[model samples]
Target: MKISKQLNKLKNLNVEAEKCSTREEAKKIINKANKAQSKINK
Candidate 1:
């Protein structure tokens, strides 16, 4: 995937994480974002 697209997804994940009420939900989003960031780094 493109870097820009990955970045956008990461940004969205961060927003979702911030809005999430549960710690588990936020952790999941953060994990997803971290994976996306790793993919971008590759």
Candidate 2:
């Protein structure tokens, strides 16, 4: 349940990433999400 919830959150982040004006902007958003996810995992 937790994993699925986390995945859903990431999916939402992906949608937001697509809205980013530039590739670099998207990467920054995704990278922040990844860091947040890693912290959650730990």
Candidate 3:
């Protein structure tokens, strides 16, 4: 329950981070999101 809540929070935070208009900002966001997803899968 706690981990799932954290994951959902991460997803919402990532969504907000992804709204940045700069390429650098978006790249960082994508990388962070991928890492989070990988962690979740493991």
TM-score of each: 0.85, 0.55, 0.64
What are the lDDT figures for the candidates, one per model?
Answer: 0.91, 0.80, 0.74
Compared to the true structure, candidate 2 yields what TM-score? 0.55
Candidate with more favorable, higher TM-score: 1 or 2: 1
| Predictions: Cα RMSD each | 0.8, 3.0, 2.7
Q: Candidate 2 on 1-42: residue-level lDDT in tens? A: 467677777878888887889988988888978966985686
Give the winner by TM-score: 2 or 3: 3
lDDT of 3 by residue, 1-42 (tens): 356865986777677785889888888777777766777777
Model 3: lDDT of residue 20:
87
For residues 1-42, write the lDDT of model 1, one tens digit per residue.
899999999989978987899989978998899999998999
Task: Please list the residue runs of candidate 1 whose C-alpha ends up more than 4 Å from where it truly belongs after superposition.
Answer: none
lDDT of 1 at 15: 87
Quote the lDDT for 19 in model 1.
Answer: 89
